[model samples]
Target: MAEVNFCLGPHVGLRPAVPGIKRAPDPPESYSALELQVAEPPVQQLEVISGVESVQLPCRTTAELHDVVKVEWTDSGDRKVHVHSCVPEEPEDQNQVYRDRTEMREDPLRTGDLSLTLRFPTVRDNRTYTCSVYSRAGRPRVETRVELQVRAQQVEVDSGAESVQLPFETTADLPEDTLVVWWCDEPEPAKKVHEHGTESDQHEVYRGRTRMREDPLNTGIFTLTLNRPTVRDAGTYACRVYGAGLIFLREKTFQLTVKGVSVLLLCAPTAAAVSLNVSPNLQQFFSDDSVSLSCVVGAQAGGQAVKRTAGGQTDLCGSGFGTFDGSSCTVSGLSPSDSGVYWCEAACEQMSQQVNISVCPRNDFARCPFILEIPALPVTAGSEVTLRCRNKDGSTHAVYFFRNGVHIRDTTMQRVKVEEFSVSEVQQSDEGLYWCSTDLLGPSHRSWLSVRAPPAPPPPPSVSLVRLICLLVVVCLFCICTVLMVLMCCSRKTGNKSPVAMEMTQCFGEYDDIAAGISTEHDF
Candidate 1:
């Protein structure tokens, strides 16, 4: 053991001056008797804006400390935020508010980056958080505290009445002496509409019209009531709550919109008759093409139609569609979202007419526009021909067929199918223009057909002279052979040998010889 002696002066009982006290030099001990304690690192403060997509809570360790096997995060209210362990491989237990919103590094033990990511951060997440690490032997090692400050959220409110009350509340428990101020539009320079403790310079417009209910400590309600709110009072209003020593606790902003009689007066109408019609009246469209719709406005029916006319709305066309003139709209490279009821309205009598436009994908032919199919032109007059009307999507409605722009007939099928009109033994009258229409939004295109009569074939060919002569020779030979046979039989019965019979028999014998030779040649 080693003993030390202090060289203190007589003034040691009082506060010692510099160089008044000294210690002995040599000590034979291997180590000092007093142990020095190492203090933990200071807490980190992180500020975040409300409604952020994500936030990262940092907690890092060094490379030499490889035994960091577990990380735990807990809120200031004693609620578990997240827990990651390498022990039993069981599921972690997290708070309901932070269940699906928290994530850490995939290989945290190796990387030493045990950072928590909170997604879709809200205002209620502002508080103190603790992150503690443990070794594989279940020994607590390092810890860190984080202070999270989230900025206030902004809200929008629209009112149609003359008077309105804007309500505000906070989750933080503030003290009784906290200062609360209501500011309009800009709260940085403090556009003080109303304040709790002190009198401030307020704008002349809101000096006597705005009031606040200062029950922040008891009921937590700091509602603002504005009397006779006009269009000029429509803007952002912020409620700033301050703690002791003028420290800002939290802020809440409200966007107000006041709609009164003055707004209605700007939208008043005039007295006149108006009518509208759409050109190139496309009942439906496809996504691959562009659409151009022109609204033709007239003072009366079929009287002096004009384009570029403004209607009740400031812009005549709606969203996803643009206007060159006030009355014409063009939608380029249309999409399925462009399908809706499009209307043109005039200021007089609120006159408006709607045209439904349906946009479909290029691959979806069933929802495409109507089409008309016609047979080949110049068809035979006695042939059966058919005309068909087809829509991309099948319909069960009655299909009407027209000829020369006049209704001819309608066909209704059991199951809604493509419409067809067939003409049996078609006449020349059926040669006119033809088209078919179903329940589609518009008429189908027309096609022309021409009917023609079939021509008569040529008469049969006349016989040649050589063939006529051959037929006569065959008849004479047959007669001669029959007579010879009769005469030979009669000569045998009556023993009568006539000259004419003998001559005919000689001729028949000669003819028989010629016939035999001819038959032999034909056989070869």
Candidate 2:
């Protein structure tokens, strides 16, 4: 018999089973069995084995055995197994599966011996069994569970086969809340392949390739139909059952060996090499740039394309923002979210090649006015100049100034707020192409500036030699007029005397001195 465990609570430890001593039935010469009261939903047992001639289902009671008014037994499928009725005073209504296959121990009614003996048990009889005991009057009903398992089995299947089914199954009359799970036994913790419940987390590898049979409980077919079985599918398959309260009723494992070619060859081409390439070998793509990805197969055709985004999920190549042909894929208006790895899968080949892609958003500097203004161009070397940045539309966009294509300063402004970047003591290095832009998205108008040394000073004001000569001539003429006037006055005063004439002559001679003196004065 397989080991069975009972769970009372998740945090609590397991409850050990009470050992029961073997005993013979009463009136050994003439065997008799009683019908046990069946629970609305059948109760499950802990353990049972196939190929057993007889097995004892033990039940314990705290009250006296004689005081027990009635005891009942039911199979995992809610099938009537046996009933011992003290009120009716008889055993009846034994299910056909166990009609003459059941017996009671001696003094059961007197000793409260609620144990059941199942005769000639086989694989078909392997299941959960419930035993319920009811006392006289106001006593509540007591229920216990027992689960049974058959020996391990092995099954074989063909690789690349359309479908493979596991033969394990449960009876049709299961409770509405029955849950079943099929999983791989090895690779410990068991990889789940399929499940039937409110929630299930099936393994990714088995997704879309595995499913459970329809109406499993009613058809007693717990088989899992795996579509397109591969060699990796060959492993031990386990099926576990749960009752209404999510109680673990039973579980069984079967070794599955897939026969045929290796799964690797089936899933992929032999010695096939595929490559992924992007046109223009773009490391960064603008938002509106069109992108095309080509799968270059080495002497092969029918390559399948796939893509993975930043989230590390593999999806069809053109599923999102692209259209994929057999050999290539194209995407337009690539955004930041489109950055990830792109994969190319060659037809009939398990191998794939991937290339990383990056996308960037386009900047629109054209949206805002971008102008660079130099206060004065061809400016002096030692002059302070301001480069005024302005936008005609008066937007508060961030402005970046660049000199000869190199960024100089970045600033933000409000409406009509000019970015006055001053250059102190302008130098040769400051003479270059200067441009301002709202952002890197668009182009900006550039202007050049030239720096040079300061100009020479003008000569001081002075009089010419010609102008001095002209002034001297004018002074001589004025002196001559004054002398003539004085001579005229003397002639009028003294008339025609020889002595006067002689005196005049002397006077004239003296006058020569005076003229000489005047000339001397003029010279001074």
Candidate-wise lDDT, in order:
0.58, 0.60
Predict model 1's lDDT versus the native: 0.58
Best candidate, lDDT: 2
lDDT at residue 222 of model 2 (Cα atoms): 75
Model 2 whole-model lDDT (C-alpha atoms): 0.60
lDDT of 1 at 482: 100
In order of listing, the candidates' clash counts read: 2, 29
Candidate that would win on TM-score: 2
> Per-residue alpha-carbon lDDT of model 1 for 161-243, expressed as tens digits?
33577777665456888888888754222356777655454433354456666555666677777754545456667776766
Model 2's number of clashes is 29
Q: Provide TM-scores for the models.
A: 0.27, 0.32
TM-score of 2: 0.32
Runs in model 1 lying further than 4 Å from the true structure: 1-38, 154-524
- C-alpha lDDT (0 to 100) for residue 205 of candidate 1: 37
lDDT by residue for model 2 (162-194), tens: 468777654566777888888786644357778
